[model samples]
Target chain A: MTKLIRLRFMFAIFCLFVSHNSQAQTKEFYLTLENHVFTPSELKIPANKKVKLIIFNKDKVAEEFDSFDLNREKVLFPKRKSTIFIGPLKPGNYEYFGEYYPNSARGVIIVEVNYVN
Target chain B: MLINTVILFIKDLLPIFVLLCLVSTCITPNRVPHEKLVYVCFSSVVGIFAKFYYLPMMGELFDGMGIEVIKTLELVLVYFCLLIGCSSLLTQNMIAAHQSNLTIVGLVIFTVINASEFIIFLDSYLANSQSIRDVVAGLSIGLGICLSFSALLYFSLHWFIKKEFFTLLYVVWALFLSGQISQVVNLLQQVDIIKSSGALWDSTKLVKDSSEYGHLLKTLFGYEAGPSLEFIMLYTASLLLFIVTFFIKSSKKQHYDIDRV
Candidate 1:
């Protein structure tokens, strides 16, 4: 009886944790382009919500968040900054990378709905 | 303001329209509108997703196809043009513009300057062992990406651009012309006549010859960035021949008006 009671408590606590995480607010994402590559190389954002993307390229070379998939091409010059206002969109995985380093300059923009939403 | 809107509409619709026409012949009557609509609509919508949501870097994978931020405008324009010509629905105006008039001069210029872009697309598509399944998979993926992008862009333009016709027409014209130029350049590369121009041409590399990348590019449209002297010469000659006719026609109108309206 005591073990059963303990198990119920743990299950309740786990549920609370998950519920809390799911309801958390979202914020705009920022990416830094240093050394000719995106800082995160991979990113995930909430689906169907506007996210502001601020890209800062600090390398001497020019970098761009370009993708045939995303249909977006924006250049980020050395130490330069740019903004991409996107999303509030359908759920999907989008990939982009720098034109310079096609192989290494790659990343994912995953748009997903929160479990609760 | 309205100009912008109309411009947006044509730019958005032209591709869908063209694609529909291309696939029309092969489609059964029952499936024609519905299937084509779905294909074009899907492709356009996917284009938007691919554009803003994903980033598949170019130049690194196979090269020349990378869309640098600085090159966005040109790339978009190129996409429009390529879609226009590749589609079977090109109107008489479109063909006329490509063949002889200045209506598509902008596209023609853009295509020539950005000829390397198509090469990249070809390279990526062919980035595997030559097999039907691989080819189909690559095409499917690419089409999905392109469709998503175009759809989102179209809707946004509809909401934002609103109602302009001439601008839309012009943009469409530009797209049509540019695509043909890419096709012409690509075709030149396909025929050995361009490649066999001689050893002087061998100095530069256009597509990734011998690499899976090159094979993909070659299959898409003969993308030889670093080519022998022959390819370059032929490419320039063919482009020039096309360009000259445009000017000759324009000049003829200006100088020899035989007392007619």
Candidate 2:
């Protein structure tokens, strides 16, 4: 009877830990759009999760979200939030730049994944 | 434990190991390095050309001219080139003295590894899709070509008696490592060697051959450029992983005094 109770307590602890981990490892994000130069100059995602980027175009003119690093391209209208899906990726840093304003729409997705050596 | 792991790994690649044995049975190490070098050069040109130019043309010609047999033949040749790539790239320092057919084994394994990469890496892109079936079908069909190419390479490299498989494999691997395959594939696709249904275009994921590290990825292992961040990240890790595998294999060879002994 005591052993059974101990097992139950352990199971409860495991469940709690799993639940906490799920919540704790919330998908982190860092997104920015350059107004003077490109649309989204910088983008970041947690490595290997389905990345949903909501890039807001703050510039007056239409801008394209482009990056060699991320392999995504989209047109972001001024004052509109556009989303680009990026991941479930392996770990590595990639560089992306705005195609419309190559001079300005530059950013990097510093995908920091755990235990990726 | 170590011995078991080694045995299991060999068992896993039993097919290539047997093929290597069979190849060595009918041959002895040749004394003609000069002739082998020429073939290596030939392997490089032929392999690279086949990968870049011939593949897409065959794909297009199959579609346009409806010559399925020719297309199949071309795919076979691509595999041959893959074997050739591996054969050529191996320096003399990585083989066991008892290993008379190191070239063939290396090339086949290399092609297998190459084919595996094409299969495994695409999963990262497909896993997240709402429609798993569609992503699977797309990835399979595209990568099926790679498998066919690798298998064909296995056959051609193994069966070709006069041709040293290692030299050929080395050259082809070099060309492949140069990132020329993707560019050639891209250019060929642009010219309609293979036509995308453009259904994949619907996905925002970009698999271009011309991104920053795109060429690097491509040359190393046929990684397409402009892939979604997911694809890029996965590919980079994979590339690193493969490089590590190569290094490990080399170190193991060194430990055994396989070549220098």
Candidate 3:
């Protein structure tokens, strides 16, 4: 009974540690597309970390989020939201655009390393 | 706005137009019947509507991988069909009929590709119908440019064929087709469907890909500023495939003729 209690105690501590690590590693950000244009146009994020991007498309037509630099592309439909996970990037400026409305829907992601303790 | 539309239209449409002209000229129509053209046209209309109807559903397929995979498959299939069709044109052999059928299939696939973009553009236009003047002007200018270009290209190829420069025509077709095949490789890499070792070189400083001349060269000759090792390999292989097939088919025809005599 004593041995079983010790194992259970270790398991509980390990689960807590894993959850804390995952919470620290992943970052979430939100963006909006309206009238075939990105709301912010430019987004800043911490470099070398995974990011979850939630995009809300409020337009009447679909638009593709294409970024050659980030090597990512996703189609966003009208009146819908999309979740894209992008990650572990080096510090740089990555440009993205809507394939259909290349002239209008453009945005940039600026990734920078965070030096704060 | 009109000028921008023209440029955009040219960038999207010129490559396909060039491909059609080169394929039509290279085929010589003797072995491949003209009746296939009507079938190809009919299939194009079907392809357009099918793509329009299915595009939204296409996005969610195969866990969001359906679109890229389907597009890549279509591109590769078209490339294969084009190769076989061009090969059959080298001689009126037994394979010519079957290969012509394959070419028709290729044309249908290309129609799907072409129509997808056009429908998307139309949808955008409809949504922004308030800018009707800009849309009409832009489309007209773009159409005019494409029409003039197609006319010039057709006549030029006709002149070359008239001069019996079949080999020159073959060379151009080989180069253009090779470039096109390489684009499939790039697309495959883009979607992470194919793995590449990254680009081998960078030439963007000398000639930006967005420049007019750059666009022309790309459309005419499949130029790339940064090509990966796999891309170069695929490009060279496809180019060799075109030339080898052409020569092999021509020699076989000569052998058959000599036997008959």
lDDT of 3 by residue, A22-109 (tens): 4345577888999888979988888777666778889988777766555456667778776565655678898888766788889998
Q: List, residue by residue over B141-201, the lDDT tens digit for candidate 3.
A: 8888878888899989988878878677777877776876677665554433455354577
Ten-residue region with minimum lDDT total, candidate 1 chain B: B189-198
Question: What are the models' TM-scores?
Answer: 0.33, 0.27, 0.79
Which TM-score value belongs to model 1?
0.33
lDDT of 3 at B244: 81
Is candidate 1 or 2 superior in DockQ?
2
| Per-residue accuracy of model 1 over B1-261 as CA lDDT, tens digit each | 122222222322334333332223212123323443455445444544444323334322222223332243444455444443422122212233342222132233343333233233333324434543644554455456446655655454444323433234334333333433333322222211122122233312443343445433433334444444443444454445434544554465555455445
TM-score order, best first, reads: 3, 1, 2
State the displacement of the C-alpha of residue B118, model 1, in Å, after optimal TM-score superposition: 10
Query: Compared with the true structure, what per-residue lDDT tens digits does model 2 show for residues B1-261?
Result: 222222222222332333333233223234223454355445544554444334324323433322233423333444444333233124444333334234433344333433332222233224445646655564455345435644665566565434645444433344343332223222222222332111122222454444334433443355552322323333344345435545665576577676557
What are the root-mean-square deviations of the candidates from the true structure over C-alphas?
A: 24.5, 19.6, 10.1
Error of 1 at B105 (Å): 3.7
CA deviation > 4 Å runs, candidate 3:
A1-31, A44-56, A66-75, A80-91, A99-104, A111-117, B28-31, B92-95
For model 1, the superposed segments whose C-alpha errors exceed 4 Å read A1-27, A115-117, B1-104, B111-261
